[model samples]
Target: MTRTAQVVVIGGGQAGLAAGYHLRRQGVDFVILDAQTTPGGAWQHTWDSLRLFSPAAYSSLPGRLMPPQTGETYPDAQHVVEYLADYEKRYELPLQRGIRVEAIHRDGPLLRVQTDSGAWHARAVISATGNWSRPFLPAVPGRSVFTGRQLHTVDYRCPADFAGQHVIVVGGGNSAAQIATDLTLDDHVNVTWVTQRPPHFLPDDIDGRALFDVATARRRALDAGRDDTGGVASLGDIVALPPVRKARDAGLLQASPMFDRMDRDGVVWADGTRAEADAVIWCTGFRPALSHLAPLQLRGTRGHIATEGTRAIGEPRLHLLGYGDWTGPASATLIGVGRPARDAARQITALFADN
Candidate 1:
């Protein structure tokens, strides 16, 4: 027998939990399908030194605030994981852990969410699957033939393993800056930063909270049908955190333009100069995790489904959350996800209420 629900949330991360909070308030019968065995989602696997760009007060979900870290202004990965576990217990949300969803198919007017353990028939489906699982690496020539170690940000753990080795870090985002800075702390490790373009850094005073406010303003302007090109900064740009600033002061933030191709043991620059490196770390970011929705054929060329707010334009029964700004402004962040998730829940409730 197939278990059914009024809604099925296909993730248990911040976005999923935010949706659950609003869904519970609406009294919707929903079940959150989490791929992991534990409460924390991707936070459980982040690098040890990773820290949130915002303080605990600014980084939080819908219902509860994240507890302030002792002696640390920004919460680290472990703290986030513990908070998520606590949040799950406090709310008593219906979350089915370890159920990796394999596929989602339309069954009549409902969605058949197939998981490894079982299937759920849902009147509406909310996909909050963020991008941590799908890391993207640029296809450099001779990359396959390079015999050195190559890893994406998702696979990176600590810089201890890279001691006494020459490492090349790629990308121009927050992860690239943080990882590159972390690797520089060990004087034995020689680090080189590469980017497609000059990296943009937000001023030291601008933190995640400021970025979120800018995004909110832009979203409000757009909603009011006004032009919003106010020269505000984007969250994707690097933030001048204390460690990153220290690395810059130490001259470790020097970035080289992306090399032309990879050689046998290293990368070759456009000027025919080759830098011998032992490892290449790609912090090139990620794409949305929507493989389970392949059967729906709703994706565009950019691997994203067209959406009006959180609701899928072509498939009304489906809603997407926390993918990126395309779904909602700053939807990928802890504080920014709640607004979109709440809107999605309201829409879903209204959709079923009319029936």
Candidate 2:
């Protein structure tokens, strides 16, 4: 069966929810399709110790502010899940959960979203599928032959699972740092953290709110053709989360240079030393989850679709929201996505007017 609307949104996560709120306000007929069976999207899969980089109020969707969590400077994953569920209910966004979008194809004057259940055609499509589904691990030598257990960010759950094991965490980003901190509490666990370079910890006072402001400033600078200032690239690699602070103060959070290669049961450094590890966790990051859009043949270098604002450069009717800075400054964050989402919805409305 083929259903139709003015817009079809892919990936009903934070990005999709933000766009849905704006599209509703714009009075456009739209539906958001989510692959997950429940609310919270990727938040549902994060490690048990995961916490927001920002305060609840600073991390919110467009239409609603996140309620403050009791005694929490950074809300936990479940709290975020509850907030997203409530946000969905409050807005009454036309979201269809448990529906996986297979591909999006051109259908005459419209675009067709082929899903496992059925098909939906729309005048425009918003691809908000964030990259959690596509975790990335760099090709370290002997990775395939490494005898130790290997896990990526997608497969990691809790540090308790690694208790008493020599765990090697690879990456300098927030996940590697936080997970390392969490692992420090596990009895008899030895964590060997390796990063390409020393981790850059943000100022103790600079939180997610500060970063969002920086992103806003950078966006405005780009708009004026001025030198870009204070984008995420200019900031530290890790936020000073409470656990991270405790671990760092205790001297448990320092990192060594990345290993040159992985051998059976461990990693080897360029200095001809080796550390035996029972497990290796790759907090290496992710690529955009855009396999469904492959049918469009629109991605260029960097495996991302080029964009003018939120609209795809090659397909005006498609808006690729919340991928990263290229789509919009900090659009990947809950707070930063609002401005770009508003722009995308407004552009979609204008496209209809032009038609």
Candidate 3:
């Protein structure tokens, strides 16, 4: 027998949980399918001391609030996971953990979701798999020849693990900066950061407002066609920027270019500078994993399904959240995904009424 739901949400992170919560409040029949054994997605895999750059107030799921961290810069990864657990428990949301969805196929007006457990025939499906599905590592020459330990940031756990070793951190993102900063504190570990661009470090807090407000405004401007610049927000232009530049001045981080290749000893920069190190931590960004949705037509430059509102460009009844900056506030963060999810729920409800 083919089980049915008005909507089937994929992944159980903050985005998926918020979507499910809203759907439940709307009295819609839906199921959340997650690949992990629990919720919280990438946060579940983050390092022990990892804290969100965004504060607990802004970094929360819908309905349930993040616990008060007493003016702390951010909540650690474990706290984030516990918050998601609380959100699920409070709402009594229907989520199926440890269910690896194999593929999504079309069957009449419904979408057929095939997983390791079983199949779901849903009228509508929200692809909340998120942007971190696959880590993006640049293909550098001689990467395989390096005699040091190489790992993506996803696998990094703690600085203690890398103690008494020379570590090279690659990429200029916040994650790379945080990891390098943590590792540099280790007396036994020598840390070097390599990246193509100097990061625009925003402050953790600003004049009583959370630092995310500036980011949110930048995103809103980008969405409103006010900001023509390509996604890079400089620190000076933003309000109450953090002391990241001070850290740079203190020689905590050395600005450098993208890694060119791996030397026999360690790593070579694009500028032909070489450093012998014990390990390289790649903090490159991530890409959405939609391998299961091969049947759905994705119209973007890359194969991302182009969406205007909740409607998929080519395929009907198939919706995507967290694709790019397409839907206003729909692709930015956990809060952004809610609008599209609610739109999707309403669309699904209307579709059900017609039947």
Candidate 4:
């Protein structure tokens, strides 16, 4: 027999938890299906040294503030994982672990969510599976020929393994910068930062809080039907973490333009300059993990399902949460995700109310 729920939330990450929180508040009958065996979602997969740009208080989900970091100003990846686990336990949210959702499709008026464990017939489905699983590496010419070690940021752990090697870190984002800086800490490791364009860095004092404020403003402007060019910091702009700041002070944050292609041992620049390297760390970011929704034929260009708020366009029973700004402004972030999740919960509640 197929199990049933009023709602099924895919992914038990920050977004999924937030959505679950709101759903619980509204007395909605929902179950969050998480792929991972443990809690903390993608936070469990990030590198050990990775720290949030915001303090613990600022980087929290709905109904619960992340417990303050004792000695650390910013919470590390492990801390986040613990916090998420505690939040799950504290709220007693109904989350099923190790249930990887394979596909989602419409079953008459309800949605059918198929997982490795079983199927869930849900009145509404929230796809909160954030972008962690979909690391994107650009199609560079001769990438297939490179014999040296190559991995995306998702696979990166620490710079210790890369010690005494020439490493090329790709992309201009914070992840790229941070990884490059981390690699530079070991004198034996030669690091090169590559980007399509010069990276933009926010002011030293500006952290995740400021970025969240800017995002909130942009969201408000867009909601008011106005242009959202508020001249504030962008999510792509690098925040000046202590280590990043130290790296900049020591003249280590310099970035080079993207290389032309890859050779067997290294990368080749457009100017025909060749840099021999042992590894290429692609921090080119991630694409939305919405493949399960493919059966619905809801994906538009670039694998994105067009969304008004959290609800998928042309498919009212489906909602895409915590993917990115396209779903809702800064919906990918911890704090920003709450807005769309709450809105989705409200809408879903109203739909049930109508019946």
For model 3, the superposed segments whose C-alpha errors exceed 4 Å read: 70-73, 203-249, 270-272, 299-301, 327-332
TM-scores for the candidates:
0.97, 0.98, 0.88, 0.97
Residue-wise lDDT of candidate 1 within 95-148, one digit each (tens)?
998899999999998999999988999999999999999999888899999999
Q: What is the per-residue lDDT of model 2 for residues 1-355, given as tens digits with 9 covering 90 to 100?
A: 8999999999889999999999999999999999999999899999999999999989999979999999898999999999999999999989998999999999899999999999999999999999999999898899999987999987888877887789999899999999888887676788989999989998888889999888889988999999968686588889988889989988889899999998987999998899999999999999999999999999898676888989999999999999888888889999999999999999999999999
Q: What are the C-alpha RMSDs, in order, of all predicted structures?
A: 1.3, 1.1, 3.1, 1.3
lDDT for 104 in candidate 1 is: 94
Worst 10 residues of 3 by lDDT: 236-245
Q: How close is candidate 1 to the true structure, as a TM-score?
A: 0.97
Once fitted onto the true fold, the runs of candidate 1 whose alpha carbons sit more than 4 angstroms away are: 230-236
User: What is each predicted model's overall lDDT from 0 to 1?
Assistant: 0.92, 0.91, 0.73, 0.89
User: What are the per-residue Cα lDDT tens digits for candidate 4 across 278-329?
Assistant: 9999999998888899899986786557888889887988888988777777
Least well predicted 10-residue stretch by lDDT in candidate 2: 228-237
How many steric overlaps does candidate 4 have? 0
